[model samples]
Target: MATNDYTAILNELKGEITNMVVSSASAYADAAKHDAQALLSDMDANLQTWTQQLATGEISAQDLAFLVKTQKDLMKMQALKQAGLSAIAVDKLKNDVINVITSTIIGKI
Candidate 1:
């Protein structure tokens, strides 16, 4: 194949990859919004009493460890949610890249 042909194929692949990136970004945004809302709701439901205790300075030293653990769990969940969203985007990106390469090769042949 000519160099120009190769360049054209690459350009086409770039366009396809750009579209995939946009779609993945949109999906990630939607999922992140949903997950964040759920996280907020869960926190509200689970932590109101804890929050009140801390606010009132009534939390015993014994309970402090439990509160710390609960907070660590919350942080872990947030990280996992972000990782999940990133994985989804990455998967979409990989699939799009593969499809683009396959099509370019087959079409050239």
Candidate 2:
């Protein structure tokens, strides 16, 4: 192939790769956001249930407070876990993209 042909192909490949990376990253972020929201909703529901139980004499005030504190701690841990997973996912995506681009360029040459 001519120089121009190779250049054109490489440019097209680069554009496609860029689009893929952007779309993938957006999708991952959306998924992470959804998961976080779901977690929050669940925590809210649990807190409500606990409060109701306490009002009904099912649990003592001390127990309620402890439960609430424990739940809050769990939520914090879950959030941290999610953030760590997100970071790992982003790193993996970066590495995968780099590998793909490198292989493509190597093959082209």
Candidate 3:
């Protein structure tokens, strides 16, 4: 795989999130999918940069995860909130998304 390829990294990131959102049985699954994609898109630049760093050994998997978590502001789970999901559930989902990011990058590498 081309570690320098941002699009490839993005596609993998998106695929993981898409799978989670689509597999859910929630009534607001579509809205959740939209929200998730929006967050991912908003943070695409940072993700791409970090992915390259991980591939080049400039950052370890733990460092990548730390960076991903630092972007919690991007977790704006509007759909989940509107669907009455509690803060705990939303937080879990947020971490789930982060895990998706880190694991996907590691897998790609």
Q: Each candidate's lDDT (Cα)?
A: 0.81, 0.84, 0.74
The residue-by-residue lDDT of candidate 2 on 1-109, one tens digit each, is 6898788767877886788778877987898889889988998899899999999999999999999899889888988987898788778778877777787777776
TM-score of each: 0.66, 0.79, 0.37
lDDT of 3 by residue, 1-109 (tens): 7656768899878888877655543635566677778777868988999999999999999999998887764464554464575454566667888898888777766
- Please give the RMSD to the true structure for each candidate, in Å: 4.0, 2.4, 23.6
Task: State candidate 3's TM-score.
Answer: 0.37
The model with the greater lDDT, 2 or 3, is 2
1-109: candidate 1 lDDT, tens digit per residue: 8999889888888887888888888888898888879877876765777767877889974686698688778779798879986987788789878888898889896
Error of 3 at 28 (Å): 9.0
Better of 1 and 3 by TM-score: 1
User: What pairs collide in candidate 2?
Assistant: none
Candidate maximizing lDDT: 2
